[model samples]
Target: MAATMPAPAASGHNGRMLSTYPLLSSQIAFGLILAVGLYLFISERLRVDVTAMLILLALVLTGVLDSKQALSGFASEPAIIVAAVFVISGALAATGISERLGAWIGRAAGVHEWRTIAVVMPAVALLAAFTHHVMVTAMMLPLLLRHARDRQLPASRLLMPMSLAASLGTTLTLFSAPAFLLASDMLQRAGTDGLGIFSITPIGIALVLVGTSYMLGARWLLPKRSGTHGDDDYLRLDRYRTELLVVKDGRWTTRPLSELHKALGARFRLLGWLRDGVRRDDLTATSPLLAGDVLLVEASADELLSLHDDPGLDLNAIVRFNDTVSGEGAPQLVQAVVAPGSEFIGRSIRELDFARQFHAVIAGLWRREGDMADRLSDARLREGDLLVLYGRPSRFSDLAAHHGFLMLVPFAGEAKRRVHAPLALLILGVTILAAATEWLSAPLAFLMGAVAMVSTRCVDIQQAYRGIDVRIFVMIAGVIPLGIAMEQTGTADLLARGLSHMVAGWPALPILLVMFTAAALLTQVMSDAATTVLLGPVAISLARTLDLPPTPFVVCTALGAVVAFLTPIGHHGNLLILGPGQYRFGDFLRIGLPLTVVIALVSAWMARWLWLGGPLLPLSG
Candidate 1:
């Protein structure tokens, strides 16, 4: 998430005159007006970042907060920590450690659904909690989908589970969820105390268990869409088929296919031979003696094209140049899924200059629910849109490698060295040390880790920048001032007073549950960071008025805000998988609602046990 400016102080220059209005009512009214505007009109009309900026501007104009306060969120530690987390996550991805883990999981679990879910969910969650969920989702989603397709498992069965696993994985730590960071900052600002690394572990663990159980049950509840039965159609191995020609004047015309194989080694394979359009299945090592013969082969377009240009043989008359481009000069076809928070979202190929800038052609485009457009050039791409590109082989490969875009086809060519293993392990070690020893703050340790990644070349400078979600940073910077405004205007205190008056006779447990539910619901409609920023202070004020520890209520508000799963609007991770998972709007509601409820109940109880007294009782008015 991006950083936001805090609202100006109430007694500032403009506030000196605006002070004629009652501070508490005016502040509450201002906050309500902004919140309603965001919820009802701005949300549907403007980009979230734009709307957030508008809110920030509103706070400043109203004298609810000053310029410095409004911009403070950008400089906040939580924002820096999140930015660092993204960079580190990118470094890990560049090293292929995340892929190795998925490969290991696939190998270990093989095709068993239960075993796969069990190992994959917790593993991804634990790993992602420290890193960015976007990285985790990008790395794991395609792998899971491919594995499921290979094993003839239902995409419907596996995709949702994978998305959930990645989402749940992020909830394990504060840095894991952007919402947590925002809430933590708001709480600290409100003088309610900030959460330490692993401070939420007790409640987080319980939520995980409940969420996992809900997911396991959801496997039965979720619709089971069958995999495509026609493997040949989906696999499209025929597209990879090619024929090498042997001309009368060619140097290698007299050599057997095995001889060519021996020279080329395993880099190229000889499928069979074609003699005058007649198929020859036998690879007789000694059967040479042929001019004008054709060799049917299984090789990539690049390899075929490279051989086309070799001066050692006469390739002109031997090879038939079909629609397929061959050699390094030939265009390569690659498929990639656009991920959440990608800068490309909402832009068309024309606007992006995708072909001119990237040196690629948009061959095909796919969205989960929408009809495939006749031309990708005119279609606007959204997060989760799958794109097929025809481009220079090297460029296509490079695009897939660096950008978090998932290549639909199995990776071809030599694998990059696995730097992810040591880097991931190092990050884990640092996180553990910081969490356990408290030698350094989590943010500082993570920042150090990000620096290490850059210095060590785990991720390049370009990729590090690409990985950071500037939109989120902007949102954070814009919303922070509004949060500050709520506090300075006495809006939070007023809201808390009103809530306490209404729930005076109700048990504290129910009140806490209501607060948690409200936060969760609001998170679905608004930004999670904004939800926490707005509600956390109110929750804390309520606790303070009741003469109880503010920690439990504040923690509930924070956790509740982050646990929104019922809508794609709630979290970027949820939106990231929509197109790839082939999920509809209803799909999220079916699975996420129960999980949200389960987490809310469990988190509330855990907070009570850990922070509040054994059982919660109503406050005596």
Candidate 2:
């Protein structure tokens, strides 16, 4: 009779399950939308913002959410703060604050390479703590390039480290990264105390210290690509091609070419030697030099300038990229680096025939490969390859646009409104103080700061508008609704239940650790903001299921999303340095793997200390 009772209960359980399945119809539709959304985001088949719009539309049509909920994200506080940050950061850059900071960095660095890294990286981290990470990285990029060139330091060594520091800065403040802002917004919407402006400072300071120390110590692990050496210094590296005539004053008439090469010593490369207007084909290291022989020498501007001191060689017509000859009119000298996704990658200058197509001379090629001087015409171009071209100014622009090249030299936009830099800095300080003291909300404080920037002419209104990244704004506004729909449709609960079941026996620390780890893994393939949006609801629900405060869990997830150290694509800051540093994908993994592990452990522990009390997990009654 007892066994028969069990069969009836089993049938009743099955019937209840069937009823619940029917009631979860909207949940099932939301799930399909989510799957497709994640696929579109990860595959990048469509623009992220466009994909987000589609997902929001699907949610409304499926009746998972009303139009109000979907559109609310556009006016959300987090989105406002994000857009304001761009304007503020642009003001800082436009008003010469960043450039002023560069001067301070240069002063602090003196002449030591290690000093530069120590001063610059931490300073960059601190500035980025309150501004856009990419703006900090981009504004400081040319400064570092110039500094590195002046000091004759390897650029690759400093660029990756700087980019990494920009990412680390996000951990220091709630508003520094979109992920943290979104996380804080989620916490507030849950009726919990949100993260303060500097809530993450304790853990952030520790991580920045660890990151800076690790980079300095693990310098050996960083790639030493010197092909891009001396990029910004005028005529610093292999930029001059001139004719040097062997003269009789020093009696070089019987000397071999080997002696000339040995004497030049890193100053120049021998291209061709001509005697009596005839190019020598039999030229060898042992070939005898003639008194009246003209040697085509490739050298730096400075190196060629100093050659006037040599009595044995007379400086003839400076044939720097045939600057003296022009079919397209007065030639302009421009330095261009290959942009990302360029078709020029893997193609040689000889194949493109710049001389025929644009009538431009590919005078110099700087690559990370280390041996680009001898084969400028035949060397295959790679992303980040810096080329010095001699051509008409208009043609240079057209060619750069046609090819995927970013002109870095003769850039007219570096003009900074230095007079207003002080005002900009003061405004930034006031904004931070207001938010930190709770005098005004973060969004309001930052928005006020942006307005002040325009009013003070720190950044013109047009510049402020241009600074705003429309794609990110649209993406955040669109995807915030997805998180809302997940909660509305009970999808967040479903995921929370499943995750809880997976970690049922886990202690408190591991739960936080798992959240952090999951965030870190998801962000490598998607933007950090998107990762936070998708994970924020799940995290909140998971903490609720464990009967714990959601702050630690949410904060942990944000920290994980911020590091983005594992790959260049993980963050725009990383991508900004990719070509300049000429780092391979594996370089990020090698350096970032250990760094990511260290940050995860420290951040999880810190979250436990700061937000959680005694138990890592709540004790079951």
Candidate 3:
């Protein structure tokens, strides 16, 4: 009876039995929470950050982690670094430094998509190697869109490679990706020295070279689908009509249309003039305007919208105007997309009182299939439907941040904020220097830069506040505890032991490859940083169990975490480009899967060479 009884229980960490469920309770709860969190994250119904908060709440409530553990992520160094980096990026964007660089690159790469990628990707990769990839995407997006519009190239041809390049660039520097920080922290806590600032530079450079060369083939590989509008499309005056009555004491009363043109630089055609209900066809640049003159103007929607900023030159008394004039201010045109889970999804625009609530009129509607019918009032807004909005520019800006819609077009005046560019650049330089020299830690250095940006007025406090993507911060903070739970629950060791058992007799190089492959695959379902944090310790444990060096495995995990190219949800950069690129879900799989394979193979070899001292596998003795 004693011999037939179950064998003695194996030991878990802290002298607990491995077979006992109470010790494994935390692991079970964490796994379920992760599963539920992933479902919500991929559902596209709840916002990503909302899902993150739910995960955090679950961790605390399930007793898998205490309240302090749940809230500790908010104070983590990675979270601080991410938030501070956002403000620094905002300062660059506010001061037009990014715009200037984009413009210069656009001009240099003129008219050729191939030439543009060759120039833009390398430059973006270099910049991304230093800054966060998301910031690099933010700065590069407007410029690329403008360049595509000017050149008539499809956005599909540019965006995928650009996004991919940004992801690759993160491998170059320690501070470039949040995953690296997590890996470094894990390594340090595991009794190993953390990675140096430039430790991964060699692997990063290799990946960039491979990625850029492959991206040059995008001219043929990428789709040439086009949806960007040209100047003529906006210039269709029949679609947008408005009337203006001149004030008797206005500045334009005695001036000719030519003088008004020279003064305001507004490109509008004079259809005719109305004086006491008498129509006159004599309208030209040299045509004189009189008091109480009514001008029938034929101008593009953008031209009509640009009138908002020129309050001094035009005394406009609107008569029966349907658009471009609101009680708050002159209405401007911008683009907004109906976001997932929007209330307007199934309802027609006419029923929603969209103009009253949003303070904007939909001038036109664009769907992925094509433009909706001209009767936009009756059209139902769907997720991903792009609506051309006409309203006060300030209101339009606010509407962009509303949960119901995602703003696709930026305000025109943003480019004009170039006067503060020098200060923004100085802050960027000092932040980089401080981090490099260890004068302050990476997070503190960036925080100082962010503070300087606000204090020096490179970016106002409000803009700085708006620039910080709370979703990203919350996501990072929230998911970090899940990683901690994995270790605390002995889940990392359990998983690592299982993996080691499977690959027990495998050659060293193949084991490293397996580690990278697993890490890369896991990133598709969750964030890279979260995957890195959870799996970093597992990789170290697996290496120890296999009697191999842990550095190679850790390095493999870090490099693999950043190669999240298999799915759109794999990286925030990919998500940012999804709507603008007009990409279907498979778009990423088509371009990214191959890229992932190439990058993983090359990266694996490089890791083996650098950390293992060669690419060969040891004999399975």
Q: What's the C-alpha lDDT at position 447 in model 3?
A: 86
What does candidate 1's lDDT look like per residue over 362-452, in tens digits? Answer: 5445465554332234568887776655566756556777554645562232222242357656865786577547688767887888887
TM-score (all chains, Cα) for each model: 0.68, 0.69, 0.67
Model 2 stretches with alpha carbons more than 4 Å out: 1-23, 227-230, 233-415, 614-621
Note the Cα lDDT for every prediction shown. Answer: 0.67, 0.79, 0.72
Q: Is candidate 2 or candidate 3 better by lDDT?
A: 2
Write the residue-wise lDDT of candidate 2 on 103-194 in tens digits: 56666776676777788779989989988888888867766777777788887888888898888987889888888888988998889988
Q: What would the per-residue lDDT of candidate 3 be over residues 1-621, giving only the tens digit for each residue?
A: 676444442223424544567667888888899788778865657877788789889989999889998998898877888788778877776665665565566678778888888887777887787666887886677667767887888977888878888888888888778888777767776788777667788888988888888889745877776534432333233223334556566666777878654432233555557777678765666877777776655433434443433332231322222443454665656767789998889898778877667666665455655334323456677898766666676675568678888656843333223446787888889888888788988778878988998999888788889888888788888877777787788888888899989997887777777878888898887678767776887898897787777877888887787875888888889888887778888877887778878887777777777777784343422
Candidate 2, residue 311: CA error in Å? 49
The candidate that achieves the highest TM-score relative to the unseen native structure = 2
